[model samples]
Every structure is written in C-alpha cells, then in structure tokens.
Target: MLVGPRPLTFVAVALAAAIVVNSEAASAQPDAGTSQAAKDAARELATKGIELYHKGRFAEALEQIQQAEERYAAPTHRVYIARCLVGLGRLVEAKAMYERLGSEPRPREMAPAVRDAYGAAATELTALEARIPKVAIAIVGASTGAELSIDGNPRPLPAGPIDVDPGSHVVVVTNGERRAERRFSAVEGAKVEVRLELAEAVQEEEQGSLVPAIVLFSVGGAATVVGAVTGGLSLAKVSELEERCVDGHCPASDQDEADFAEALGTTSTVTFAVAGAAVVTGIVLAVVRPGGSSANTGAAATSAKSIVIDPVVAPGFIGVRGRF
Candidate 1:
C-alpha cells in the first residue's frame, strides 16, 4: 500500500506538467531504433501512469512509467519515477534518484516543464534523505557457503545497517540442503534488526508406495531358499566323497562329484551374500526418502513414479535386475 494517500502529491502534479513537451522532444527515442509510433505509445503510457498516480495507485502508476522510460528517453521521466518510488515506500531508491537528477547538468534552453520536474526532484531529495529506514539483517544457523539475499539481490555476510524504504520486505537465507525466510516492515526514521535462520533440515517425505521394497525382499528371500536347498542336496555328494577318498586317495569318478559339491558351495555363498545385500537395500528404501527420487515424498513428489527390483537365481548363476 502507498503511504499517506497523498504523500507525493506535489511531485504527482509535476508529472502532469512534464509531458507537455512538443512532438520533436517527445519522439526522441531512448535508443536508435525506436519508431515514432513507439514514442507516441510511450507518451500514452506516461499519461496513463500520471493519472494513476493521482488516484493513489502507485504500483500501477510505476508500471506504466517504467514502460514509458523503456521506449523513449526523457529527463522528465526520472521525476515521475522518483515520486512513484516514494509513494511506494521505497524512499531509499527515491532519494538516490532525486540526488542524481539534482546534480545532473542540463542545458539552459531546456523545456520549462522539464526544468520544473527537475526542480521538484531536487526539493524531494531534501525531505527524503533523513526519513529512509535502516535495517540490520542477520543470518543464523546457515550452513557454510550458504547465501543470503533481500528482495532477490545478494548481500555480503555481516552487511551492517542498510538503508531501506519504509514498507514490507522479505529476506531469504539458503544452503543446498536447507532454507529460511523472514518478513519485516519498516517505518521512516526507524532502525530494525531482523534475523533469518536456516536451521530446518530439508528432508524428502516418503512417496510412491512400499510395494517395490516388498517385492525386492521377497525375491531375495526366494533366491536364498533355492541356494540353501541346493547346498543341502550337495551334502549327499560330500558324504559319498568322504567314503571314496579314504587313505587320502580318490578315484576319477569322485572328481566329478567333488566338483559338483564345490559348485554348490560357491552358489550358496554367492546367493546368501546377494540376498543379504538386497534385504538391506530394500530396508533403506523403506526408511529413508531421497530428496529427489527415492520413495518420492513431499509436495512435488508424484505417485506415478516407478521403481522395481528383483533377484534372479538359477542352478549355476545368480543376478539382479531393476529399474529406477
């Protein structure tokens, strides 16, 4: 909201007076390529902005004035911009613009209307310089290498009391894993200390379902059971070898059986390890949600995400398959 309904009424009146320039001056583009049509459009916009300002619509008025400035160049436009900022409670910016226009050199033959606008700017400067609020923004619990900003502009850490307009604003602090924000308001001649803390840990909420984990563990258990049963059958071959290899001597027939027993032992060891790893992985998916994808959770997470894991086992080999 604009402060005090008619806070910058005198300057608003100057806006009405400034646009009374002749066609040649009004058509002067800010850059080389702007057409006369654009200059005319800009004038229309500026006129609209001025009317809006008179009605206490500072935001709408500022929008129009900005568009006009972009299309055509004019020293008088600065006058309206400064006043709009003042009405919008952005006194710091208004004061700076006013100071700049006051010190800027101009021709003796300049239009009287423009001259009056500059005069108004100079007068405004004197009154606003002392009323700008000061804010001492502080950050707490922010991670190393975290960044802080005010209204989207980055600020150095420990940046002491800064000049601000008397209005509402938001300060933000962010690290890769956590973020925090603080909103505050300021009044003329007031000093404020504001703190933004990034102490909340950013965690992904569980999304999707437990179906994937359940399937993975079930397949892993099945593989383990198959490996165990095969190993038990190999015990019969082991006992026969023990009888045949008496006195540390065995026939060639025993070699094939011994080889079969060793194969069973290898399969048991591999399948058991693979099964344990699968179970552990499944448990992890069930417990911890990834910020981006795992068991998707939070506002952005979608139920349509797909994940599958299955353990494969055969008589002589074992493997796994999954899509994430």
Candidate 2:
C-alpha cells in the first residue's frame, strides 16, 4: 500500500515545538537531590529530535527519541516516537503506539505538555483507524496440506478478518502441485474479501490412441464392401427383370427375382448409410480426440446435437443419407 505524505501546517509545527520547549523547560528546573545532569541530557536529546522532526528528517528524529527514551522514560517521548514512525511510513508500529497510549489513563500529576501529547496521540489514533484496511479470506474445497500466504509471509488460513495497511498485497494459495495467485489493492478503511478454490492435481492420460478409430474404420469398410456387392447384384437382377418385362409388366416367373432384388437394394441402402456414419464418426474422433487438451481436466460434457445417418430409399433411388 502507498501512503501519500500528509501536509504539515504551521500550526502543527508550532504545537510540536511548544511541546518540546515545555518539556525541556520543565525538566531544567529539577527538584532537590534529583540528577540534574541526566535530566538535562534527556532534555537535549528531545530538543534535537524535535528539530529533526521539523526538518522532515524522520529517521534521525526517531533515533534521537529512542536515545532520549534510553536516557529517561517519558510518555511525551513516546508521542514523538510514534509521530516519527508515521513520518517514516512505519504505519503499523505507529498505530500500535497510538493504541497503547490511547488506552492508558491520564496520570493525575500530568503536566500540561504531557496532557497535550496524550491528546495528540488520541487524534493520531483516530486518523490511523481510518487509514488501516482489513482482509478476509475464504477458501473453498481446501485440500489437505493446502497452504496460504500474504506478501510472501505464510499465515494460517484465517477464520476471521486480518488487519493490514492500505496498499497492494499478494495472496497465494497452494495445494500440492497446483497453485493460485492474486494481486489486489486495498483502500483506506476498506474491508476486502478474497475467495479461492483449490484445484485438484491429477495426472493426465495420453491422447490420440487411434484404437477405436481403427476398429470403426475396419468395421465400416467391410460393411461398405458388402453393401456395394449386394447393390451390384441387385442392379444386375433389375436389368434381367427389365428384359423379362413388356409395357411395364413383368411375367410371374420374374416375381421372385424382383422381390429378392428389392430386399437386396433395401439392405444395401441401410448398410451403406450406417457404415458411412461409422466411418465419418471414426475420422472425427481421430482428429478431435475427446478430452485431449492438457488444459482441460474437468469432466466431459455430452450433447444431443450430433451426427446422424439414415437410408435414402425411393423409386429409382437407393443411397445413404447423413445429417449433422
């Protein structure tokens, strides 16, 4: 997530400088038996830190405040430290400091400067609450050994929401050899939900076996040859019957031949049509190869709109019919 720099106004700088001055001035007038040297050193560090903060040297300011904290513990220094963290774009740490300070009860003997620091912490916490974002993850059909990570840091599959800073984030889920990744941007105060479904990993069988195609081709070719022979015999019988016929009238002696020829023609037509369809289907299967693509692993689908074959039988016509 990207955070734009907040504009610093004169009023803010004046208020921060006033806190530093007031703290140093208060510590300068030490009580009897107090270690004036140690208090003076802390006051000097706090002053330097405030100068750095005003100069926009957040890193240096943070170091100075840390040094002051080491020298002398003060709630006011924590306020400066949190401000430095915000300036350095360490928002999560800054937010924690703000939260901690906001929850603490105000001390009874708190100086006006310390009271002002606590007030500032409260204000900063309110702003941070609006800037932080949250994410919720939902996994569907998560297999055993499935792992999830955010920004390369592994985390347990969360049952609830997780807070994050406003910015770009990467979410990844892995199950066995299969993996899924997504990149998303989170806006300030946004509650984003990412749903992922793990895909099962399975070995794919080889394609283009050609065994079924070969078998169908052989069966269809034999039927076609048989049908051709029957059709030729039928044609010869018809010619012989024509010779016996006069004025479209055939003698009773040719009746048996005529009936046999008709049967042969009908059988030839039916056989040819079925055989042609089988051969065509075989060729299509050889070319297409159902469930062939490596990218496709799901169950196959069936449809009714497919190739069909029928016989064409009419007066002076005997052939196969194909429809797609």
* Candidate 2, 30-144: lDDT as tens digits: 2334355655676678777877887889999899878876666666677778888878766778899878777765545555556666778787778877777888888877778
Per-model TM against the reference: 0.48, 0.47
Please list the Cα RMSD from the true structure of every candidate, rounded to 1 decimal place: 13.2, 13.0
Which residue pairs in candidate 2 collide?
A: 1-167, 1-168
lDDT of 2: 0.70
Q: How displaced is residue 235 in candidate 2, in Å?
A: 65
Find the 10 residues in a row with the least total lDDT in model 1. Answer: 22-31
State the lDDT of candidate 1 residue by residue for 111-220, as single tens digits. Answer: 55566666677667777777888889877786579887888889776658988778888888888767888889988989999987777675655455666578768867
Best by TM-score: 1
Clashes of 2: 2
Cα misplacement distance, residue 104 of candidate 2 (Å): 3.4
Q: Look at candidate 2 and tell me the lDDT of residue 73.
A: 60
